[model samples]
Target: MKRQLHSCALAALTLLSTLPAGAQHAEPVPSEQRVTVQGMKNASAWFKAESQHFVVYSDTSRASVFQLLNNLERLDYLLRLYTSAYGKPQPLESKLTLTFHKRPGALAQFADTPPRDAVGLYSSCSAGVQGAGVLLAPITELANAELSKAPVND
Candidate 1:
């Protein structure tokens, strides 16, 4: 009887070892790694803030969308402080549009000029229909070293 019990236990151990690593519980993919396809959210779906100070473009999810908005708001406040301390040649427009992309490659479609491998871009154009806005790449790409470390002023 003892010998049979030992054989059964060994068989069970062998069976468990043969199973795939995910047979028990698969690890969940991190949110940053689970990027959706580019342009998954259409331009029409962009959330407009109450102040119209800026518009958020992305399919990342409402929570992330709002977080960007808040960050922009804070950035604006900081800019105001700097301008007041120094002084601007002319008044600046408060309204803005932020284009947040799920992937770095997606920015090429919207760029008026050649796109860089930038993680984020604050850009504008002199004329010909390219307006002012900031383009944000995926959170995972934030540390890309190829692009300029400084933000593009336009």
Candidate 2:
């Protein structure tokens, strides 16, 4: 009886060890989709906001989009100022488009040939059509809504 119990326990252990690993960590893969500027514009649920230098489309709150756009404009100005010393300032013919997704999986669907685990995507157009210079990113939601407000630009 003791020998039979030992054999059964060993068999159960071997069977459990042969099972596939990481079953709990598996996630449902999102269906592949092509993302485009027009596609984003057609997404009725998305909110749109525009600044002097950025055209943002996001599913996040309007306040957050506006705040992000303001910061982006300020950063663009600073970068231009720094680079001006090196060469003549080249002006942008059109405002850049930024598409903000609510989650990383959503952003991945829009990325152009993205890696298996991409967090963000940025594409620069040297001489592309208007609105072709697009960026896809996930919004980092703040715990407090007050923190999303942009500082007043004097």
Among these predicted structures, which one has the highest TM-score? Answer: 2
- Model 2 has an lDDT value of 0.62
- Angstrom error of the Cα, residue 112, model 1: value is 7.7
In candidate 1, the residue pairs with backbone N, CA or C atoms under 3 Å apart (3 or more residues apart, or in different chains) clash, namely none
Model 2 CA deviation exceeding 4 Å by range: 1-43, 112-118, 126-154
Residue pairs with colliding backbones in model 2 are none
Instruction: Report the number of clashing residue pairs per model.
Output: 0, 0
For each candidate, the alpha-carbon lDDT, in order, equals: 0.55, 0.62
lDDT of 1 by residue, 1-154 (tens): 9999999999999998895666577698764423445767533444434234676556455666666676666666767788886876445554555666555465556556535655555656653122223345322222235235746333
How far in Å is the alpha carbon of 128 misplaced in model 2?
3.6
Maximum-lDDT candidate: 2
lDDT of 2 by residue, 1-154 (tens): 9999999999999998896765576688985333346646552556667888778767666666766776677678878888888988557557777776655566545555666665456676665422211223433433334444843321
Instruction: Report the alpha-carbon TM-score of model 2 versus the true structure.
Output: 0.49
